[model samples]
Target: MGRTVVVLGGGISGLAASYHLCRAPCPPKVVLVEGSERLGGWIRSVRGPDGAIFELGPRGIRPAGALGARTLLMGGDRSQTQHSFARPEPSAGASGHSVEDWRGCPRPLIPT
Candidate 1:
């Protein structure tokens, strides 16, 4: 029988470790256990009504090291340009809305 490794949490760290372990010359059986229903942990993104994409957590990542750069390159979305966020706006701010006017109490204070 092969070896077995149980990984706790489904965050990037756990996922990367599991990926590397499975990709090794001699891989072991790995079982990942996540306490929460959702994976990716603190990395989150949301689309606003204005169509602007906002990230709630770690949005941009710098891949300098070999593995880090490889992971970034492999995972990168080629269709989307690197400066996609800098695209010109079709309209002014959120129509006639303001952050304060949001349905739910605004979590972070977005400066105008």
Candidate 2:
């Protein structure tokens, strides 16, 4: 039997770590634990009444990193939907608002 590694979170970082760990030369038993019922943590996408996609939290990923590229490919329509919005809510908010208001800034401050 292989060793087991229990991941504490289901966010991108934790999931990426677990993925790499499992893909190692000698794979281990990896189990990801997400406190919330949903995965992807702060990243969530919801469909609007008009059949458009709106991200409640962090949206898509940049296709730079290997994992990010993979995510973009796998996300498919959801990824495409990300670009459909003319302007995300967070960025459209009044300037100098709270940190929460800056979440979806036109382009995420971080590369992701």
Candidate 3:
């Protein structure tokens, strides 16, 4: 019978909260309750009908922001996102977040 912190949603904020909570000195039983099948709710990538990986709202991967940095501290597609972290979005970053064509290579699932 220990303390438990239930984090609602699997979005960036929720993920950050859960991650930190579990990393505390005496971490609690952090239970991340996400509705969807995947953890990353808003920060998601989907394939188009033509087999192109399209990114939705990419705020989570941008390293400029605090939360994004925290989430990225958990590790993201840094190769594709690092260069664009300081750069503003919607400014010809069409292939910036592409998982398949990351520097012309395959993106690893487990963060190294």
TM-scores for all candidates? Answer: 0.56, 0.51, 0.51
Ranking by lDDT: 1, 2, 3
For model 3, the superposed segments whose C-alpha errors exceed 4 Å read: 46-54, 59-72, 76-112
- By summed lDDT, which 10 consecutive residues of candidate 2 come out lowest? 77-86
Query: Candidate 3, residues 49-93: lDDT per residue as tens digits?
Result: 555555676733435788656655675423544322233344445
Candidate no. 3 TM-score: 0.51
Q: Which candidate is the best by TM-score?
A: 1
**Displacement of the residue 68 alpha carbon in candidate 2, Å:** 7.9
Ranking by TM-score: 1, 2, 3
The predicted structure with the larger TM-score, 1 or 3, is 1
Q: lDDT per residue, candidate 1, 14-92, as tens digits?
A: 8877877887899999999999988878977676776666777763565688977778765553455433222123222
Clashes of 2: 0
Kindly give the number of clashing pairs for every candidate.
0, 0, 0
